[model samples]
Target: MGSDGSSSGVVREPLDYVGVTNRTSSGFSLIWDSPEEKYKNFVVTSKDVGKDEALKPKSTNKDSEDDSEKEFDNKEEEAKYEQTNKSESENPRSKDENRVPESVSTPDPQNKSGTGSKPVTGSITSFKKVLPGSSRFFQFEDLPPQTEYTVTLLGKGPGLLSRLHKLVISTGPEPPKDLVFSEVTENSLTVSWTKPKSPISGFKVTYTSIKDGEPVSVSIDRGDSTLGLSQLSPGSSYEVSVVSILGLDESDPITDFFMTLPDPPTDLRAVNVTDTKALLLWRPALAAVDKYAIVYGSGTDSELRVTVSANAAEQQLSGLQGSTTYTVTISSQLGSNESSEASTSFTTTSGSGGDGDGFGDLQSKDVTPRTARLSWKPPTKPAGSYRLTYQTEGQEVKEVVVDGSVTELNLSRLHPSSRYTVQLQAESGGRNTAPLSTHFTTDCSQELLNGILKSGEVDIFPQGRSGPPVMVYCDMETDGGGWTVFQRRKDGSVDFFRGWKEYIKGFGSLSGEFWLGLDNLYNLTSMTKMTLRVDLRDQDEATFAKYSTFELVKRNYKLIVGGYSGTA
Candidate 1:
């Protein structure tokens, strides 16, 4: 505070604690603590602020400038007077005068003819502006942070007098605010923020994935408020933080959380095919999904839908039509949303649809040099009849047609000990199933019997035995087809079965070294021997009865007569 421009016997006290507090990036709180205040204008001045600063130099160097201005004016006047005294026609000066010694004609600063100009005065601070204030405090806003500001508070006093107080203060830079995320994809994210109140050097964006446990950071210029982060993990949660920086100081950070979507399913396929059922499988989602949804159908009108657990990678659909093509769409579902669809198509096994053909097992036995016996039942599908087509080397195809009721056929005229390709296909409604194929060769010396195996049981023997051989035959039969032939092991354990279908039909193998028997033949007495003979008592009926066993000897193989031998 100050008094009027008069020697009045009065002393005015200064406003108490007139300073700044609560300094921020762009502003600070200015306090004028005086209770009684009467002023016309509040003049505020902010000096040049820097990180490392001493006292700011004065704005104008007046004293030295005034002295230099006077000297320069005196010289300029002396040169002008000399030019006026000499014309183009003036006599030459004396040689002594022309050769005047150095420093003899120097101008003096006290010359009355020189114009003495007063040096200009400038304000002492870098940034000065007038502000309005009343009461005890004035909030000084919009000042730069991280800088040194020497602010002088001024007030108009009585008459032409003014009161002032000089202070050094600076505001802190503003921190970035309201960070948001957009355009979030499996591998990247875009984040944006609102600019703060004051200018800053830049911003520091720090982000980290919770699943990966790694953090990344980048610097953004002051002109840019958005940052794009790339190379991120899919279906992962991340935390992002944005902070404003001014010089070496940084504002408090603002943070947010987000997650990337899981990738779509890949490599979809079908398996375990049947007329009415099929199994569907696919690779798991690349990232993660709440669950999976499948839209499947032959077409749009009959579309069907199903849902699977998030971790499930496969599904099975039943009640499908045989040989009918189906289209399936799979998608990764997250929350209330689902990803783009991945599609695939497949057709069920054809030939048989609905309950057309029942289950059946095929087997073969009694292979000779020129003939092989093949037996089957329960058509994969119902059909009119069975056809056994066969041929030998350089021979015409010979086909044997039989009623659908028959199940066994003997393939003849095959080459001796030669391989032949065979096809077994199920037929229904004039449509043939894709043939199930096999290969077998005619025997060299061994002979086998021909018979139907509808009951899953059969008896085999050589055609008219004449000499000792390496094999023995068992002609046992069962009601439930319970007695399966057992194969003997070198260790003496009958743990394996002789698969006759494997040997004759080329389904598998049965060597001469393995023993054969019905492990559980409930229809026969334990180790009991039986024989039968065929007879026709009526013109329409033919049946078989037990026959007597023949006493045969062969040291190479002891043939056990344990099964029926009958004619039909």
Candidate 2:
């Protein structure tokens, strides 16, 4: 290379040189010729510059060079150091009032090493280099930006035990103010702040729960990006704070806030019914106000309406088709204010003609000793089923439901002499007809029979105390004898017996056993004791005879009369 500069400044000495024998890709030679060698020698790649002459200061140090180096160092420091804290007081100390102006102006770099020289620039009112091995809390203030101010540094040991040190302070810009965290949620949050007119990136949030004793930090990316706060439990309160991470500066911490989630609703219910109208009723919700919306249909035809109010306990919806089922729902309008809808179903009732004979005027007839026949007329319309019920006095009803129309019913198991009421109701198309009642009684009159008298039976005799006593029994031992009796007469006249008169006055009483009977008559057996009497009568006279024993047997018998015959 040739020199183009002027006079004496141009002759820079050229050192004795040797040519390289081996070359590298970087255009550097690993081997150089040695002046005393006939062979080549290799240059050491790893060299140690020991603490001897190697560290000696360059003898040609220049004020301009030192100025340039210092300037370059200042620029590098400017790029690396950022303001993290800005201390402010309304009134600043006057220069004359300051004990030392230059010593307390810069903050110590929290992390310092020999690799670089970065001065924390802002005047410190009181500075303590947390000794290389020790840490202690410190406080200070800085003047407002653009203000010409001087600061002094005085180091105090822990617990104010050590003397003040002569430390220097420098100034560049104040650090950014603390960041604020608000509207924190399980997964994300909003951060806000004002920087100290210094450079900085966006803010970050560091959080931990009581469960996670250790804190976890998140860098809040700009532009509403969602930070994953996933896997968090609902209804839990979390401690969270935000901090601003300046380019290469310290982080600033803010105060913490908490948040929680809402709970779910419980005990939902619904009930459905069918009248001419189909209505739905339900128990109210505790977590939210609910409105009822009915959805009614069979399979394909359906209708929905939200006409029901929150305060209304019951609602009637009309114009329903017969035998049709409808589904109903009660729900909430707002999502956060919502609950699960309750569901129910019902079938509409059918209509009946006012004059269904099968259900009108039930009548019980054809009564017997143990049963009664109940009869009714058929209904005008067809029925799905029929229910006939009856009851005794103060007794439960006996009921039967049949599939078809049954007009006449037989009710057995009735008491012999009892009355019963029968009621009939008809069910058609899910509707029940009105009931009718009638009463009937069973009969009891076939309980009387005839009795007969036999032999060994005795008969009671009639009293013979009349004017001419008659005999009830007589001796029948004679050849032509059967049961015979005698009449008596008081007058003694020959002509008294002239016509149709018996005149015998005396006849001995027969003592032998005899039979007494009459035509169209059977034996009489109720007579416990008996007596015999005889009566003999003529036209004017009559006599009486008495027997010692009375006979009562079923045979022809003869009787004796008194010993006189008036007619002869």
Candidate 3:
């Protein structure tokens, strides 16, 4: 008898051949030849080796059974099946033991034949029955990717030992995971992903522009996990897909969406500035945008941000501080994406008298013990009149109005050695410009006989009452008070090694280290008999040097002293 357990002359195997065809990531097909003799039916079973639980056989519907019986009735279907089988047979990998026929009995855990035997267990399985003269082809569906499956086919007949044809096949690789997009710009973007654990030869990447509906594709080696795409439109959207690939197989594509950055606004500038507001202008961006974002602030201050319609070419900023410089930045935006920033700077006019106005510089000259002359340049814009106000701390403010054509004023009745703040404003047609302000101290000699004893900066007219005021430091507490300080070196905040011109005009602040001008020194010493006292200190130690008489001659400010006495 042959392997089919038949008494006939020579019985052939139930199936001549079994091979896999139409393999995919999720499913595959099994094709076999017709048996030598007509059989009641054929039983096919499949098991996933990676799974442990036994799977119940699937019930075949009457329609499916009828379809299977006539599967091979169509000549065209037979020819297609033959072609598929031929191609699979040509592949050397198809000749493995998995594709060869074997002799085996179907296991029945119930032992329905009353035979003493143990049933097979611990395997997930699915079963299908095919009638004789059927298509000789069966398809496995809805299987996991990158999984191994064992499929078996057996012929059933009366009083016959059916031979089994078994084969092992695996689905295609799984798709990539955790896809990400980064480093996006106006014209390019990057995409990356985590490769699947399943073995694969490479990947296929495809991206489509949502605006134009044009797709671009690229192939990448399995070793690479990232790809960079360029030449994209700004402010545009895109859809990307990644698929894992193996020999003659590709996984379902993983898809995602992203956007490119927009172009920034151009030619940003400040068009106008006032004490409380500013107007900014810019050109529109070349790319399409939904809006524009504006950010403005002064030095070290918290910035304020606002947005305007994309069609707007100018923005008005309000509630700003006067006489302060501010920086403004503008950027174009589309959806969640924003473009690079375009920036500019401007300064606002003064808000009030306390803060100087944007008008011309104000100066004080011809100062005396009881009078001062204040002068300024005319404002760039014409004014109807000018208002001048002056006051000292804790004193009532005084005001004076002058014709707009006048730029200088003389004030009288000012206290000797007293500091006064003066404010000047230009008014025209009921509107006034921000005030221009300055401070000045009336002149006083550094002597108790002059009725001045304060230790502070003071204006002195050493060349008599007709000359401009010369500011100097008076040290009233030392040597019975009333000492004029010509030179001081307390802190290193000021640079002393200066050119002759700087020295002639004096280069430091009276509140800090300073040198009284040489010309002032010559005029002062030439006016009165003065005593010189020098005090020096290092860390905690101190010393002094004094001269009973001191004076400076006119030529080159030559110094002369007599009767020196001190601990130095």
Please, what are the lDDT tens digits per residue for candidate 3 over residues 465-487? 55777887878788788788888
lDDT of 1 at 455: 29
Worst 10 residues of 3 by lDDT: 65-74
Shift of residue 324 alpha carbon in model 2, Å:
12
On TM-score, the candidate that comes out on top is 3
TM-score per prediction, in order, is 0.36, 0.25, 0.42
For model 2, where is the 10-residue window of minimal lDDT? 445-454
Worst 10 residues of 1 by lDDT: 66-75
Summarize candidate 2's per-residue lDDT along 160-197 as a digit string, tens digits: 11111111111223333444555543334454555545
CA lDDT scores, all candidates in order: 0.52, 0.36, 0.68
Best by lDDT: 3
Instruction: After superposing candidate 2 on the true structure, give the runs of residues whose Cα lies further than 4 Å from its correct spot.
Output: 1-138, 141-197, 210-214, 222-231, 247-249, 266-568
- How does candidate 3 score on lDDT? 0.68
Question: Which digits, one per residue and each the tens of the lDDT, describe model 1 over residues 99-129?
Answer: 3223122222343421211111222235433
